[model samples]
Target: MKLSTIALTIMLGLSSSTMAQPKDITIRLVETSDVHGSFFPYNFITRKAKSGSMARVYTLIEELRKKNGKENIYLLDNGDILQGQPISYYYNYVAHEKTNIAASVLNYMGYDAATVGNHDIETGHEVYDKWFKELNFPILGANVIDTKTNKPYILPYYTIRKGNGIKVCVIGMLTPAIPNWLKESIWSGLRFEEMVSCARRTMTEVKAKEKPDVIVGLFHSGWDGGIKTATYDEDASKKVAQEVPGFDVVFFGHDHTPHNSVVKNVSGKDVICLDPANNAQRIAMATLTLRPKTVKGKRRYTLAKATGELVDVKELKADEAFLKHFQSEIDDVKTWSEQVIGKFENTIYTKDSYFGNSAFNDLILDLELEITKADIAFNAPLLFNSSIKAGPVTIADMFNLYKYENNLCTMRLTGKEIRKHLEMSYDLWCNTMKSPDDYLLLLSDTQNDAQRLGFKNFSFNFDSAAGIDYEVDVTKPDGEKVRILRMSNGEPFDENKWYTVAVNSYRANGGGELLTKGAGIPRDSLKSRIVWESPKDQRYYLMEEIKKAGVMNPQPHNNWKFVPEEWTVPAATRDRKLLFGE
Candidate 1:
């Protein structure tokens, strides 16, 4: 009787399988990362028409949802959404009582899920915490752990069931190197785990709990090699996809470089990885198709095809509905942006900063020195190929002048440590100058490098010092290029004696590894090295100073210059032409 019952059950299962043909299931995930508050087709800072924005992105998303059933479409954002436009500032600081424009806009756009970016954390607990609560959809962070509760800080992963009964899961994580760049107070009670470790553990739980047919990874870290340590990598999305075995699609951002490729996991199964880059310029779309596979005489759904592509939002027209719906908010932002703070006597261009000193770079350096009263001030071309017209300097113009809300830090450093920091900076900024004809800048023509604010290296890390008279010799190599003669006060520079140096919080926090690796200061020991820290962002002080002065005239310090004029003069001229025509 037992043998007959087993035979009948097996026969009935086979008959049911033969009678019913399982249909193919599809799930489409569209992602945006590093939107950076470009919500409209206009640049609030420049007050001009820009190429891409969330308005334009909305148009494309609407069309995508229409073509593919809305039930099968999932919209996600990787991160870096809370900073950048003057409008964002208007909502973040000025209109603090109301719902943040970022959360409100995303809610209106119907974003299914999002991840908090490093920049979002920079807003501190007050802003990001409020923004986090305001979001309609769950903000995901598998690696962001709450130390108090010892649980996931946010919704680690979100799962949705498609109309065809295909369970799709999306996992989110940010880089573990947040502490290396941000202050402790900002990310208080939050600890970031390494991507691979978190991904592996999270995958195990997700596989057992959700039993998802399709899995997607939405990460905020770059592809590879941002900040490498023995324990963690700042950009480890690619590494996780390669090591973890479950993902069908992985989307990442924060490097601001577009990528669409495939990586094989430990199981030798292909995982599609996509990045849309920054500023709402593009959207990464991934499609997953699942088909039934016979396993042990039972049917199970598995990923049959996974594909990804980046769709450009630049060419798409802005949705009128989006603009009209938020017209009142846009007008309010414009009112705040147009409030004139000061005036400029002369026009300054950041393009001139690449070759050597420029009025724009000097203005910021001078501000740092005066504000901190330090012996030396380090400044970078944060503006990066922008210009300030010789006219009214409004709040909007300040955003263009100083790109980030980095606080000024005054740190104690020996003359030797200072020199080493500059060595690292110049190494990344300029070439070896093997010959006069060789490009002075280490220009990389690769697509990814060129997209980095028109420089081979990130221009924000191209730090130059004021209050010291120095010359960069074109004939020397990276470490030997800088030659310091004397301090600006004509005092003898001593490598053994400690001196107060002024820098931005980003540098002090080891944003570019200049302080830790170049200056030989340990990351944990940086706070002790600080002599003083500005109460607010350096830009705030700069604005106050400008407001007090009413009319500001900025000039290059000319305290430092390039040596071997025969080599430097021609190289600077030739390279400027190569970089920007005419």
Candidate 2:
């Protein structure tokens, strides 16, 4: 089983248990994060057996509940459950009239409380608002505030009382960097507060009003050092845990890396932090024990022990009752996923996109150009490693071909801005190959917890331009790598001339900082640059266009390639094996 970096042992501030007159009290929290709709043991997209599922997590939770009693065990989740698979899309769009399968499943699992993730917000207000209404327990996001009222859009915190007169207050906050990725229409009227500021303010409120014995932070943010701007931090869980004094245990997600650590708060108190990676593969469990003590001749509780670990759920079989309970919904999603959407004349692998122009991304780029009739197009591979074979394509294949439900965006960009954007992308993607032996890809210097060869930046941010002939000189520095020769149609590419560009909604809204940092466009002024946006998502159009075509012969545009082949050719082959083990 794969386990993420387990940093440190659990450290306790305080704990409570449910034993009428017990000498020591122990409280346990079982947390799952970024499940991404992996409900069953089967992978709906792959049509194969996968490592983890919420059904398995349910089995483990049931075992723990039976052993510890429900009163002492609290089931928690750290969101991002609304996207990623055909099942979520089914419930999100197809079965909108019915209750969301996510709500039903989490409700059946008896989740104590949960936090709203960025993807949940990405589903837009209609979907998340409906799911939020259907959930039996509250979903928290203290930092997500209503613009009009200046109050939290959702409940800031929820208090759960155990049978043994113990109050556990759970405060939830998500990453405040939503504006960088999402369009305003998706999260309209809600503003995100920075994690540290939000945590400090909420902590003060919790101490004053609730005055609970133990505080648990269920943050839908990741570890520190994600995207940091002067306004907000995208991954501020570590920062919040370190700065906020009252929290006993902090469970975070959204980075999709499991971790366990102990960090001292501002008051110099020990705080346990844990993050369970995405897809229900593992969960974080913290058992905190508090022993009775005397303070000023009064009965008080002192921390005895605090231990947390990442429990692997990969080996566990799917719980039969859980599968049976959601049988209808599961079957519906499977049927939808399996429905034939189109056919492919040849297979396209996303792996090739990393090297240069490939059919995988070119298909998307070509489709965008046809749809928008723009002079230029920009795209990046959404999936890390995925393929669509030369045969009948299903809805599942469309999901792999296009990951996010981003709308198609047609924007205007100058030829100079286009050059800058490509430079920034290659800077994140490829390293300066000074010699033939130097790596072509910009892999990270250090290994992450899972011992994987991590990229210097997210692959989804490695945008490449189509509709123009260009060469990226591997020996050149960051800003000077890309050299545009001419348009794909043999027209002169003037740097000063403006051209209509097709892009994904995320990019148009300033995701990956490509437009803002690379193209030198101001973030707030982005909307003015957009010429048009499709009503439906890119995925839907990709499916419809392919279906209309009868069969797609996927091929790379061959519009661009890496220069100094003496270094880049062998480097590409070596780096491919290093990254994919192929």
Candidate 3:
């Protein structure tokens, strides 16, 4: 054969082989956020196995990987994994000398990356710093910068390569509102930058340097576009998706609400945005299809389609091996949670707080007043409908009572400001009743569904005041609802008098905007107004108070009441049944 003919034949064979390769590839990305230490299919509060768990989520991930090919699947956690149940508390505080169970589980599940959450930072440097060091995968936090170095405190972002040489760059960002919710000592040397600004800067760098085929943002914030009183952007995931152009997909949590949609960017291109909710109840999945195109006789891939959805994991079965591997830790947590601290003389339920003052909230108020010796105390139910029966109160019961690791805070406020705060709370918590059939508690048809009635806002923010007598008139408008009667100690209420008020750090730091907006207090001056702050979480003090008392007999202070009892009482009773189906 001639040499020219042989060369031509070889070139043809090479071209044929290249053409045989697939023209397109589809990859699936899965995310879990706000895991909050739910590694097993068990609820510590109820002391029973439940459906939501990382173990169950692992099973779903495994099934999806098997169906979609392991190389084409990537798993990531958005954040809030360090603190919630006793399992995490044990590893974080009780058994700090050993390996972190949360990190170990993430490593075992083969996570690609994770973002830092405000609650994770609330665990303090010693806990999260140790956990971050031990994690197998990179934990990204581009906005959480160190003051000393003026650079990212953790891995700003990470890039992973698939089987087809497709590079996916995942960047992580946290809410800048950390300073507003957390104490300075917890995040001492770190500064959380605004999400939009940080995303713009990070995306530019990633596109320039990595030139990744896909850019995914793992944010530990919500989808709200509005700014809070403390930060430039508290929940700026939607803003980041709208303003930043490089991100192909954005996965967010922190609001604990499930959301999935495609948002239009500044360039008029669509970006996938997703939030899987909290405690492994759901998982967010993003799928991208890349098609190969020949440019100058070289094959290149471009994203053809991107879509996102939230998958509910309520019915998924837990992975047996995953559960078995961590059975000892599970048992340890169970035993610790069951240890009786003290006894409650009567059952305390949160349902009563919705209508009038309940022992459930009054107990918290009592602890705050006792701990701080403040002139007045304010509190709200952190959980919507949690209850504790009359019996021995275990460590787990405390978790049910106090949902978050919030510290006790006492600030100075005038009587007028306190009244304004109550007015705001009542406005959000109650509705104007024109007749006896009208609903006493605020009910929004827009927020409710066929399954259950939902409040316009979180019921946890429905605050009530103690140490003073007041009345909420359901027939009046919002600003005119709350009327101060007198002090609980039989003294006349003075609107001009300054008094110390004890509350949770979240309230004092403007989490619900009651203190800053309602009270008309300057956000920057809030820290200086602090009369006293608890060194540990409020739950810690509650446990100590319980241990010291040995017998807890929680009773309502009866300082506040709803007016026009003839109309309000029946309406509240009917609404309670409608809300709880009891």
How accurate locally, in lDDT, is each candidate? 0.88, 0.89, 0.87
Q: Where does candidate 2 clash, by residue pair?
A: none
Q: Give residue 153's error in model 1 in angstroms.
A: 1.2
lDDT of 1 at 385: 75
- Per-candidate TM-scores read 0.94, 0.94, 0.93
- Candidate 1 off by > 4 Å: 1-22, 162-164, 292-300, 447-454
Cα shift from native, residue 424, model 3 (Å): 1.8
1 or 2, greater by lDDT: 2
Once fitted onto the true fold, the runs of candidate 2 whose alpha carbons sit more than 4 angstroms away are: 1-21, 292-301, 445-453
Q: After superposition, how far is residue 78 of candidate 3 from its true place, in Å?
A: 0.5
lDDT tens digits, residue span 163-196, model 3: 7767889999998888767778889999988878
lDDT leader: 2
